[model samples]
Target: MRETLRVQLWPLPTLGVALAAVAGVGLPQLDARIQLDPPTWLKTYLFSGGPDAARSVLSAIAGSLVTVTALTFSLTVLTLQLASSQFSPRLLRTFTADRHVQATLALFLTTFTFALTVLRTVRTGKDEQTEFVPQISVTVALLLTLASLLALVLFLSHLARELRIETMMRSVHSATVHTIHRLLPQQQDTAGRDSAAGNASGATPEPPANALPLTVSASGFLTSMDEKALLRAAVEADAVVLIDRTPGDSLVAGTPVGVAWPRPGTHLSSEARARLVGRAAAAVSIGPERTDREDVAFGIRQLTDIATKALSPGINDPTTAVHALAHSSALLCELAGRDLGPRMLHDDQQRLRVVLRRPDLDELVTLAVAQPLRYGAGEPAVLARIAALLRELAWTAPPDRHPPIAGALARLRSTIDGQDLDDTEHVRLVELTRLAEEALAGRWPPGR
Candidate 1:
């Protein structure tokens, strides 16, 4: 029920439906008044065609709207199915959020409903009563019908272009980049902090075994946490909270979502403990499926799906797999230069209150490349393409984040079988390997 409400309130659908209903309800009142002194241009047979003509026009529009609305829905559903089967099913969410398609559907429905409502007002010479013509309503319906036709054409054109592989890849790339920006802002380098903390190089000892574990209330993906709320809860309880799960992690009921511990030599009262646990659980939200809201891993999952589909035995398209790799490498490059896997959060009073777990750049790189790399091992062209992408990422990434690329290169080397490659293929493979080696060591060191 909650998910259904969320879907209904999604901005694209909500706005479209709300606007259509508003037009249906309000436009008739405007017609009732405006038809009394309709323009000189509308005084002709075209606009002043009495009750008979007005009913005919309204009926024509209402009937045509039904047909056009069905056509719009049919085309949208068919295209989405094709795109999902050919590219990635995750992209269905993108289509649902699209404003253009939603607006087209909204306009058609509004025209149909508006025409039908005004038709009810067309009292067609019953008992020889005074004939009435809703000139304004008929004129508006005609205009709406014309606008809907234009929108239909635009929708068709947009759908045709959107189904292309390149277009889908670009859309996924843009969304993942946006998610990165929101979830992983660049961090200041830690040189000064490192210098000061040199003596504290070793890992901190674990908390007391009796520390309070904030149990997860449900099983789902950890979509997001309210940082400020968690901080306040910690401050009020005079404790520190360490998050066990981050935005992309899966959760199960009864598992520890996080830990809350008082400062050394301090303890939480029973009442405080209960309140703190409740607040901690309230600070986090879980959902059945991962959301793009802040989960970078979900974005990686979409790219992985595209690559997996392309490499399947039935499809056997290494070129598409290569495209996915190129974009994945680019995304990894952008992340490599940014601050990742940091654990501290501070309150307004400048006290540390919360510690979060984050997936580091290396983990993200592996997640994005692993599945495709595994499936493409047999295709020499696929390996060559993967090598080029690895080279690009290593070259473009900051010098500090290269070990993952080196590791990937090692993995690629292990996957190659000499029996499968011809002399020509071996020569090309050697060149690609040299390129990967240079990318890792030329700026960034191996096995860091």
Candidate 2:
């Protein structure tokens, strides 16, 4: 339920439909109330009219709205298709996460709903009975229709802007940085006070030989799990639990995704172990594909895919590859300065309640840009950009963190040594490589 709401596909549209229904049902009462007791002040704004004019306007709105809604849906889907084919299919996740597109659909539906509902409230001259019209409701419906049309125009303009590669890159960049900040804990929390306490006290223990193995039955990406709930369940059962699968891990049926061991010398019965695994599994959520909501590696994968596509022989777009490396390098550099958060979490009684698995800084750097490095080494533009990136990281990160990025830079240098580039081109790349070496060595440039 929580994951569904967090990654809601049509959340805004669903609410808009409900709100339109409410407006359709309630606005007519407002008209009736006005007619029953006309406020002298509000009378000037009150619509004093008949079904002849209002019904005709509403009918027009209703017809136009249907056509416009279908057109918008088609255009939006086409835009997504183009983006996926030209850029990266991984980017399709961004389109699903967009609220504006959802709002466009909602507005179109709301306009049609409001107009049709108002038309039903109005009737023309009858042969034997009386005719009535909700003048105020119909007027409001017209206003809403006009508003919807204006919104549709804006939506079209925004959709065009969104399709531009620059806008998409900016969105991807911001999301990656935000994800880093959210998922990477502060150094003090991970390796400082709490870490020292746990390390000194020998709080965390190894899993027992008889520890129960919780094989994941479902096969998919493990998107998320309720950490608190898992911890609470473990605490209640006096069990120490360690999850082998992280949010981004792919699970195969009957694979050990986690382990549960009873406290110290205690032995939990089979029924108890079975119940614990059931509760733990219930708190975990899995999906067919990765989601940005909890899958920490998804952002890196998207950026890397973009760079890989850019560097592909068919596309041959080195500048785009360089840009992607800049972002990936920045992420890795930032990560280098922070302590990778604690894997073992202890409860109030100093017993390990939950154990987490996360990628280390070296692994993250490898995952983020390794593909592009492997593919783009021959491109001078790509190598220079990455060299500059390495220089930036080498200076900003601690001394120990240099080897991971420096090692990659060394690979670049080795590749350059073997390449058949002209002397002038080779010299330029070597210069960049030299600067990177100096930065990693914590030395200033000659004059500086």
Candidate 3:
């Protein structure tokens, strides 16, 4: 036979009921009409008595302590879980989100409710006749309330500090992406184009622009268990893993792991790309060995697949239209040889930061222009006719729409007919093409 053990958590309403009964009946009845001025020790023993007292004052204290401890632990666990949940991401996305305020108010209300029950129970007299009603001093009530509130604030403040450290980790990830993108060739293209144009118009060139250097930092408790394996994986990926320079040798945030480095040159060999993809696949396979690094490695693998597919053919296999749009956006950045998507993986803030650096519309249009010319050059007239349909499917929209790719094709036609390329026009075209790709491919972006 198996034995089962159960633990009962005290209910809050029970505390309230016990307090009311003690104040309204028990304490009052005991104190009523006694009229004897007891010594300090005697009074203390009667009110704040040992376990053997008639009302068992020590038992009440023990129960209250257990209840309060359980409540506090529950609340702390709930607050931390809430902070880390998917809801937290949505909440953070909202303009008015404030975890600190929410947590503090929750803690305060919970503590205050317990304090109120305790005060009510304490103020009831221990005499039989007075048990009908207990006298509570205003000063005592206020003091209890104030003490509970103070304790709540202190507890919540400590929780807030933990939350701050998490927030900083996210910030560091965002900063790393921002810095890396600043150093890439695609990032300098706009300025380079403008400078060349200015030179053609016989103007002096601007000063040499300072390139943003990629700085890797990381922080958190890293234990001894899998450090060597993690370091080996990083080295295999050609990414650098940086640790803090301080005494304890902690991992720093924004520290680029060896696996996250860009491809060595302007173009990767087919064999090299295959190897990189294989490495990413291997990482994904091995990640489940450790729970702590599983999510992080999974995210990295997803990003790697996106980057690989964007640069090379035969990699786009998203499951949904929205996912395709996100993948295409990331892929477009990769094709333009930009680092925006990788940044998004590193930091949540990169979602917005990526939009700032407009994608190269011309490159996307060039891809659109080439699809038909490469695949459908010499067939029967009707078969050739469907080539346009196929091209539209590949470049403009998914195959299931009413007019299939008509709307997107029309938009591209307008761009082709001679609209001056501005940042807005480029971004719009990129978005449209990405949506089209997504509709066909069924892929959504990270954090969508």
Clashing pairs in 1: none
Error of 3 at 381 (Å): 41
RMSD of each: 4.4, 2.9, 19.1
Give residue 2's lDDT in candidate 3 (0 to 100).
Answer: 8
**Model 1 CA deviation exceeding 4 Å by range:** 1-25, 39-46, 189-208, 417-419, 443-448
Q: Best-fitting candidate, measured by lDDT?
A: 2
What stretches of model 3 exceed 4 Å from their correct place?
1-97, 128-230, 234-448
Judged by lDDT against the true structure, how good is candidate 1?
0.76
lDDT of 3 at 24: 38
Candidate 2 is scored at a TM of 0.90
- The estimated TM-scores of all candidates read 0.88, 0.90, 0.23
- Which TM-score value belongs to model 3? 0.23
lDDT of 2 by residue, 205-240 (tens): 567777788777789989887777787878778888
lDDT of candidate model 2 versus the reference: 0.76
Order of models, best lDDT first: 2, 1, 3
lDDT of 3 by residue, 68-105 (tens): 54665676566546543411221221111234433344
Supply candidate 2's per-residue lDDT for 239.
88
Task: Give the range of the ten consecutive residues with the poorest summed lDDT in model 3.
Answer: 1-10
